[model samples]
Each structure stands twice: as C-alpha cells, then as structure tokens.
Target: MTDTPENGAAAPTAAPQITSRVLAQYIRDMSFENILAQKGVTGDAQPEIQVQVNLDARKRSTDNQYEVITKLNITSKTKEKGDPLFVLEIEYAGVFHVEGVPEDQMHPYLLIECPRITFPFLRRIVSDVTRDGGFPPLNLETIDFLALYRSELARRAESEKAKAN
Candidate 1:
C-alpha cells in the first residue's frame, strides 16, 4: 500500500493481478479437403474463402483448471458454380492455469485470454496442413477476442431482456 502526500489516509490497494499459463495444447480434430481433386473441378480463378470460429470453455472437475477449445472452419469456393474448392476444419484446445482473476471475470478470461494464447499454434497448423495438402498456404487473419466477448455479452443481455419482456 502506498501513502498519499496530501491526505493522511492510505491509498487504495493495487488491482487484482491476473496470470495465465498454458499447461498443454493439442489438436483434438483436423481435416483438410481439396475439393478440386475430389470433384475434378477445373478452374484458374481464385476462390472466395469464408471462415467461421467458435470458442468453448469449461472447468475441470478434478484440478479446477480450465479447458478452452477454439474451433475454426474455413471453406473456399468459386463465385459462379458455388462448388467447393477446399475445406479445412480444426478443433484446438488448451489447458490453462489461471490465477488471481475474480469469479465474475473468470468466464471472459478463460474464453478470451486462453484462446488468445493458443490461437497462433492453431493458425500455424492450418497453414502447414493446407500447404501439405497440395494447395497454397492459407494464412488466416488475426482474431479479435475482446470484440467477440463483448458481442457475446451484449447478445446474452439482449436475449435475457427479451425473455423478461
């Protein structure tokens, strides 16, 4: 605790310190499909890619640690035929040791921070797998975890308010 010069009262304590360590991370599932090879679609055109992401976290009953999973699905297809070009799906998970976060903030910390720590590894895997699967390496864009968390919170609040109404 630090003392203030002007007032005789002591200053407030520091904010709660939060620390996170990744215990382990692994690929729970992975799939890379080159639809052009399977369907023999001849095309020299660049395919439009679409990516989707999902996050889930749960507390382990045994050790009180948290397990966070980040799921990503990427698909590319032509504009005219809408035929599939390539599909890549990955489910990456990590065990995180989180300390000093308050109960009210724990959920967001686990969902956002833990995944933020583990996403680079998942991104690398996606790139490597696509290149190995005979296609150009697919470099994914960086994600905004904080925006996602805030949006999720707002959506939930709106849903509850609707139910109450």
Candidate 2:
C-alpha cells in the first residue's frame, strides 16, 4: 500500500483464487485368473459366482478435486471341489472437480455419477478378459449407483426415524 496511497485510502490487495478444475481417470490395475476346476464338474455345471465390489473415496490436498476408486472381485466356480473358476480384479478411479458444489450434494455425485461414468469401461474390460480366458463370456450384472445411493440414504433415514420413534 506504500503509505496508503498518501490519501488515507488502503491499497488493493490480491485475493486468492481457485486454480484448476480437472477430471483425471486412470486404470491402476486389472487381473483375470481362471482356474478351471480339474476332474470336477464341467458339463451341466450350474456355476456359482460370488461378486464383490468395493469403493474407496478420497479427497486430495486440493479442496475442489476428489477421487473415487472402485474395485471389483469376482469369483465363479462350482460347488464340488471348491475350485476357483474365474477371478477378476479391476481397480479403476475417477477424479472430479467438485468445487462450488454444496456439501449436501457431494455424496450423490461421488457415489453415483462418478462410478456410473466409470463402470461401462470396467464392465467391458471384464467381459473381454473373461471371454479371452477360454470360458463363456461373463456379463456382469447392471449396477444401479443412483439406486444404491438412494437406498443407503433411505436406510439411514429409516434408522433415524426408528431411533426417534
């Protein structure tokens, strides 16, 4: 302000501003292991599968950017010898610029839209891996991220309601 501009007026100072808004996506790792059950059911085998998906959400040093990672583990096999039929691991991430978004609206954006945007590619990769593994192509069940998020919210609300009741 160099002596307050010599007129009893304060000099203008620079205010901090938001720097960057970017969405970066990458595939960290993926693996498909098919261990065909040996000397066990092959024909007429009603293969049983166990599907598990895990999500990890994180915010970096920046206030506006967030990362949502989804990991899938699929194990499909018969019930005869406890053998592993197919195991798939997919680790994928989506980064988003969430600045200016209300705090109340953050959960849905991360849990639903981010994952929905990342799922089709993940699904395609899984299908390709399974098909190339000399087994029937595995078509993953459709994921309803919005529905899942809503269900979670509803469950929480119900629990609170029950507690109050």
Which parts of model 2 are misplaced by more than 4 Å? 1-22, 37-43, 79-82, 150-165
Per-residue lDDT of 106-146 in model 1, one digit per residue for the tens?
A: 99888888889998898899889888888888888899999
Instruction: Quantify all predictions' global Cα lDDT against the true fold.
Output: 0.87, 0.76
Model 2: what TM-score? Answer: 0.68
Residue pairs that clash (backbone atoms under 3 angstroms), model 1: none
Cα lDDT tens digits, model 2, 40-63, are: 445555568787877777887876
Using all chains and alpha carbons, the TM-scores for the candidates as numbered come to 0.90, 0.68
The ten-residue window of minimal lDDT in model 1 covers 1-10
Best by lDDT: 1
